[model samples]
Target: MPSSLSIAAFAAPLIQLAAAHGYVSGVTVNGGSWVDGSNPNWYYQPEGTAPDTPGWKALNQDNGFVSPDAYDTNDIACHKSATPGETYITASAGDTLTLYWNTWPDTHHGPVLNYLAECSGECTAATADGLSFTKISEAGLLSGSNPGTWATDTLIANNFTADVIIPGSLAAGNYVLRHEIIALHSAASANGAQSYPQCLNIQVGGSGSTALPAGEPATDFYSSADPGILFSLYTAFTSYTIPGPDVWTA
Candidate 1:
């Protein structure tokens, strides 16, 4: 599928795009339809007025991001001051989730990662605290030097959308999906990396028997000095090591 990106070769930068750092605008469950999965306006809604979906709300105002300086706080878990989703997405064990972002800047070269955490009960009641996440999907530095073609670049080429697969062998349960993109545009400096993570709840029901894999807390996922987190995209690099724990596949 990387061949789809060849169009980017003869037609990049010159597109004269009105770029902006973006957020999850919609999500498609099982490739069926699009829904406003992430309630972007949860902060401004009157009490109990937010849209009911698996997507949680955070303080990522104006498509803002959480800096590495706040990596130690819960803000790093989702976004700044995130709250749990009020509902859950009804999905099976092996479903494909399509995440659509509002926009992503071409200058923001970085990796894309997704993590999964199981919840004992309904995930709506689950918070970022005490949650452990195992990397499920990640891609970075797909090819070439000159900083390489990153996952974020692919997302931009695909109209700011990404697809993640749910482990087919996963056991029936409630879980939270943490999807993130680390923009390394200014990551050359310490604490200059911008982390934009969004969380959503999922109710998976199937006969598969694999249990949730062991995971690490989001706060412990990365350090400001990590090679991937504190990187300079301006340099030429053929390979990039995406930060966070090894991906868990069932």
Candidate 2:
């Protein structure tokens, strides 16, 4: 029951050449840029508020993507079930829950597309990012958690969608769901640093279906159905020195 799982090199590609004109730069993740008063590189903490139970509402500054300098788009947030402790796992009505974004990253700001190229070599881009989660109530939650202190829930918007609802009177076992992706860079005080945080570890079951429980490795490996076989296995392990070929001393 495995259809797809990818996030190794995400989408490795970040080529760039100026004077000669060669472009394809676009790959940056985790190492996008961050430092100096750092605090909002991206965040999400749900299990049960902290200090007491009345705080945790930043959702990346209410969807503005947090801009004291950066994060203009690319965010997602979700939490349902009364919103008190965020709970909902009891399936038995047309069960078919599916939310998948198996860790994606190959470009966000380092493959050099318009940020003055510098990733170098065949263009080894780095960030392509992705994540999603949905399910809201209690005024659509939005992002709140300051009761105990340890609040940080954000969702920018280059892309994000998460919705989970399974309360048909569940009574199974094993059920957990958590997804995260926080890569911030409010301009990093004019491109100094701060942008490196990509996470995804989700598991939702009760007969619904949502598993990313550590299994994402295959970001488009130059597919052609194994035709060249990595250039014929690098020309059969090249070590050419066949003058007259000692053909096994035959």
Candidate 3:
């Protein structure tokens, strides 16, 4: 058995290591803000909740943790498992929403993407397998001397936040919003890319006449074998194709 003194000495370091992993701990919609791990409306099923939920299963996952890297896999879409409550942030078209994460390390450099999927009806009970999504916003590597790296990107870099515009003409409805980051620091090796995807419930109100494009299963986006996901980002890349469908800017 270990001595109490020894155990005490090791406890602090262990706690720090665990806390180092990051997660989206809070979000701001328009002028309203809510913290994660505590907000019932945010859609994260606490790990301590009885009978674990099925959507965004990796809710509150440490930033250091990554899901199985196979494309079109279950964990790729929303890291889902639990059926989140239907509570959502209410916003009109042309509003701004911001997501805040825990400490984001500079070493995890990659692209940031946002997607939206309209719900069939009530979103609180919707299953992850039954949902479909459309690309809405994408931010790739910044252009300059050090290209293909997200380390210097303003929104990502050492910051813990990102902001996105709600399409001015978005139709009125309830939709699932997915925010993601692809960490490519280790993409040179097979199955090395780390993807962190989080989902939220939102009720969008707008007079916009545009309709969502045909929905595709999360697996339809990219294959694990795709070059963009498996390639090394150590060198300069002139242009990058975000690994997903075109954005529906309308």
Candidate 4:
């Protein structure tokens, strides 16, 4: 029922968003130099296979995302067929880390969250599936209507960068840092949400004695029928509940 110009205008942004699928290009700890376990130079295309990085490599080389239809599958753990990184980055509790995304479309707005799962031993050799993840950080609807000032908006305002703070009370160990962004631009319909989750292997060192518990697996992270996952942003809304377990605190 829309005119040609109206349809074109509407499709323009969607096309842009599709062409600019995102990926974690690099990460910095305590405001240090940027480092990436995977390809740091991912643009229109990704470079040759990454040699080493604390960040796990997902199948989103084309900057693609995982839809809600795959919620119950192992693909939701990290991205899709995610492979563990060969090494990890060292950091201490209470350290702030910045995750850099290659690009993010403002049109795609939703929630941003982080989770941590400690490995039995060396995380470098750990697998993506079956890890118990505990929510550590979450930023949902910040303010305004049309889900205004969302975490994704703030991320865009900050040049496609998201900051995550390591829990100060977490025990020293090898862990997997899972950072995710849920794009709810088309969430009005079923299976419309787009999930962009990535992982990083971190060797944490601190005197804190609180070891992360064996939390719920990533498959139980969300359900297709969840209020947050099946939400709508096309209309006005005042509040938004982040979909997932409560964040683990000291």
- Model 3, residue 204: distance off in Å is 0.9
Q: What are the lDDT figures for the candidates, one per model?
A: 0.80, 0.20, 0.63, 0.80
Distance from true position, residue 136, model 4, in Å?
A: 0.3
Which segments of candidate 1 are over 4 A away from where they belong?
1-19
Q: Give the TM-score of candidate 2.
A: 0.19
lDDT of 2 by residue, 113-195 (tens): 00011111211121122222221111111222211111011111221112233333333333322222222112123332222
Better of 1 and 4 by TM-score: 1
- 1-250 in candidate 1: lDDT tens per residue? 2122442332233233323576676677776766666645456679877677778888765667888888888888878778788877777889898887766788888899999999868778877886899899999888876667889989988777899899999998989999999998889898899999988888888887898887878999999999989888887765677998888866
**RMSD per prediction, one decimal?**
5.6, 22.6, 7.5, 7.5
- TM-score against truth, every candidate: 0.89, 0.19, 0.78, 0.88
Candidate 3 lDDT by residue in tens digits, 13-116: 43365544344445566747552322222334454563322124344333344443645565676764435543676777788886765445577777788888
lDDT of 1 at 22: 68
For model 3, give the 10-residue run with minimal summed lDDT. Answer: 35-44
Scored by Cα lDDT, where does model 2 land?
A: 0.20
Pairs of residues at least 3 apart in sequence or in different chains that clash in candidate 4: 37-53
